[model samples]
Target: MRQNHHDGTKRWARWEGASLPTNVRPPILADGRHSSGLAGCKGGGHGDPKAAFAKAPTFSPDTDFRARVAAEKFHLCRTTREKGRMGPSKSSNTAPSTLQVHRTSDLRRLLADRPTWGRLACGVPFRDPRWLAPWWDSFSESAEAYALVASDERCVIRGVLPLYRRSNHGYRDLNFVGDGAACSDYVSIACRPQDSTAVAQAMAAYLMDVRDDPDHGWDGVEIDGIAESDETMRSFAQALLVGGAAVHAHSRQSTWLSARRATWEDHLRSMAKTTRRKVRRFGEQIDGAGGLTKRVAETENQVDAFLDELIDLHQRRWRAEGVAGSYHDSRMVTFIHSVAQAFFLSQRLYLPTLWKGDRMVSAELHMIGDDRRLYCYSSGYDIDSSHLQPGRVLLSDTLRELYRRDWTGIDFLRGDEIYKRRMAATPQRIVCLRVFSPSAAGRIRFETWSAGFNAKQWLRRRLGIPPLSVVGMCETGTPSR
Candidate 1:
């Protein structure tokens, strides 16, 4: 049975002791080990019938009982609104009317109604279940998925903050789930534009209490990939300060673009004069050849085939530089394959390749968001074709294609590569934030990490030394650029 800790802290009490109800694909505990903490999946999941990308079959749960609980939760939210605790225009600065916890699988149902959530949705790659579920299941042994849904008084979900808890370097790290692998971006505490700050503050207070609970024993909460301009991170940091907690913030970057220009020509004209000239010259060259062909993956088989070509070319390009590329890791390969398959099913996957006759020259992997923005996640081009500027030409083609479709923006995802700047409007400042409660262990953990971080910026990058973090040695510890 679930129990309530009727304190003033205002968090949902306990997750019932029994197995998680429905919609959540609860993890099968290896060696009969079950988590006793309430800050984890009690469970929440979406259905996955295709095992092509996933290593294991989906775990189905009992639906009738779970459905009843969900109904009650909605009723609770509605009841709060009726009592004037919330209003359509502005809500009281107090916590949201209701806070319900969900597992990873619930993301599918929540995001399906994009009319409401779409305005502040997580990136497309993170929202879809087919992609998220398989990538999530890959880390099931080490990761515990939890989503905090903040609802207005009228039972309308105002915000959803989904995170994962895992042990990293012997510390219990509660952070974004896909941070270590695929560089998930634009992860904000989702809410109506006006309510974003309030919801962020609300979650901050709740998370602090959860960490301070003697039984919880959480070492730290690291939130990575928040844009510098974001108000939610500010609200969260301020809230933690008010609660006498410590917050450490670090900055990374993601390349950004404003494709909302009137026309493709106008967008190109906005770039640096040299870049504009270069792109036009290469574009003309490629077009003049007349044999240039562009292909989009229209089927699952095509997505897979193009993905292989991407990996092959990507690795070859990096190997030529005497470095192992991102795809060298078998785990990253599996995760990418799984996500591509899932996105293909939803028709949101874009694998566009440039070919000359039977030879492929450049390729890119993209996801079009529910909001119609495109994110260029990864790409590759034949290294031998550097004289032809394969990367620039491919990107030029992509931007023009989006322009033709009337799309307004494209996020180049996480990277500070020189090419990203040559094409991007300006780089957005993203941060890695770690908030720790007033505990000795938490303090030690923060200070130690801080010292190491300082050392890296001061020594590693400055000393012309390549650290494991930069080389992708599985130490994807923070917001990577």
Candidate 2:
């Protein structure tokens, strides 16, 4: 349980009583996505995303809420500056007062506060000590991990973002903790809603200031999975540019399903006639064939069995497509297994298996988030059963059940594949950004990565091939544009 730090517990500065422009607004994407890395609405929106897809949704933040958040941060920053701790320029005129960055491990005492802890937990799932503890612990011997922990003037925890530095082919490049493995999609900073911009700017400035003599000097840092539509991503980009750093951004569209309808039939009505008909036909056919059974993992034994089957089936199917599945990496499998225990015990995990009499045909791993979003993390279906359309059938059944349970929405994690569009899932644009130190080594490393990345895009465009995606790892969060 987290406390509400926005309840005016801290004292306000005299500037708050002055005639300063109190016009800061929260950054909510016009497309209805909350730029703060959390969904703005609980479910179904009334705003017509065109008359064709009319659905009620959680509305955007009101002006009052945004004004309050903005005003609070502005006043606080001004107050800090007035004390002569930090000047308007990077050349600090006096010693800094409140803000300090710390390693992830040292944040326990700061996080002891209810409000701060809750904010971080909501930003990133703060459960599973095993998962959180090993966040910076990359299995690769070449990688070293740490998180930049930011605190404010009053010693209140503001934000934390994880980082991992490693020498990639003699080039020291700093990437995010889960970058090498694409398990995390929205790598947002764990900051209070009001302090996101400030914290991000501070982090960027700190990175620039200490690049020459960093704790561990790295050529470049890659911030991956930022939503292109998000203001926070833009803020970081702007901050880096202001500090005279080189930045490159690559973008992709991800899929998400809006589960705001009251019933399965109502949701189906919103889909194209062709898609709806196919789903109906597949459902009947699958049901008729050996009496299809949709079962969710319940007992501990069931969870273990289902996860193993999921990995096996997913691997087999992807192998047939000439790609090793996410489970191909022993480390990834181990990580998922390690986290599965906690998720299972809490019943937040949904491991669904589709069966035809005695044989399993499809398996999917899903995690329900605190914001009521259901993440369609990973799925695997028997390739031999493709003619049965087992994948679609499984997905359809899953959505129906999720709707019945009143889940807000379903995120397809990553990739805007044909099936997702066919299901009427909304497309959100997310980008992978790399920020480089203004050094010779940084330029060299950045160019190499950019060239390779461009070459892949060229090949895909010329060959009309599907975009390369994270093999089997995909996750849910609000930061994606």
Candidate 3:
């Protein structure tokens, strides 16, 4: 018989031919130590308590001791599990590696991970660093970049949430990077489809852990223009809910045109008869009057010229209505120029000008997605050409060109404008989600703001004013008329 102590547990064994028996249990001494069942044992048989166990007849102390101990431990573990005890089982499967969340503020760090970011961005043009970096350079004077990155044990990036932090009414506010005048649509967490939930849960836990930190904590977070079809963002929102966040979501509609038809004629045939006749008539009127021509910006100089014309026309049209257009601000113009150049270099910018003989009728700025869809971001049209419906003619011609190039669709991002419906664009839902941190200050601030917002909405309803537009109102944390 032999005995050993391993890992603070007294293990008893009866060795025979250098192997421990699976069911061996030697005699126990009064001091809670196992003893060799022999008459002259050096350790526990009588006086010396610290003495080692005496050698058995067939046991060699130096022969395969570790192997024997390991085998015994494995046997015990298996036996314990079989007897319905709580212990680790001997199996090949392993637990998943934990995800690590890192906070970064440096633009170069994001740029360094540009390839990974682009892959995880999954073809959304707004999520591209090329677009976001320029937006940050132009408009981030007051805000600080606070991006969250998730990675696995192997240091492979799994997700990235590009956000900017700012102070809002004595509370810290976090918003998506391209949220304001950039008007980015379909913004979401950049991650692979399979890792979305795991990454979200990890990020939510990290947010909870930091919610009370003096410098890094956030009181509120607002994410806008999340596509309703994005399961990843929905999972992320659900994770935040599980973390006890006060999540409020508002839904709005965006219009889209299916441009996958084989030809422009086929596309027009798919529309309603009345709409088809109107679209055809608009195109014919422009072509027959003088001559219709389309100019697409292919050089940097051309891009700058087109942008200038677009800004002038847009401001003139809106000025005629006694309002400043979207491009009135010089900062916005600068941001547009910078981002437009970046997109143009990436071969994603689409600036098309429609002309009627010698007069420019309309101009549009579009960005192409990796999925071969055109995002109709902004447009400017001559109010003088309203009678000829220059905007519609331009859209029709643009679709014709896109179809010839085998593009998939066109997105009339955000807004329920009558023109979108008139052009036979179908409405799709997008959500703006606001999540308040689970901290005391966050709760109070959210409640107070909610009450005031409710009252304002009620007053608007009573006074016959339209409810706040989510697209225009969410950017600045205030309603924009």
- TM-score top scorer: 3
Of 1 and 3, the candidate ahead on TM-score is: 3
Q: In order, what is each prediction's RMSD in angstroms?
A: 14.9, 13.8, 22.0
| Model 3 per-residue lDDT tens digits across residues 291-372 | 7777889999999989888888788888797876787778888888887888899899899988877778889988888988
Where does the lowest 10-residue lDDT sum fall in candidate 3?
Answer: 1-10
TM-score of each: 0.71, 0.71, 0.74
Give all candidates' CA lDDT scores. 0.57, 0.55, 0.64
Error of 3 at 137 (Å): 0.7
Query: Considering every candidate listed, which one attains the maximal lDDT?
Result: 3
| Root-mean-square deviation of Cα positions for candidate 3 versus the true structure, in angstroms | 22.0
Report the C-alpha displacement of residue 142, candidate 3, in angstroms: 1.8
Clash-forming residue pairs, model 1: 23-45, 24-44, 24-45, 45-105, 46-105
Candidate 1 error regions (>4 Å): 1-124, 127-131, 152-156, 455-481
Candidate number with the higher TM-score (2 or 3): 3
What is the TM-score of candidate 3?
0.74
- Error of model 3, residue 82, in angstroms: 27
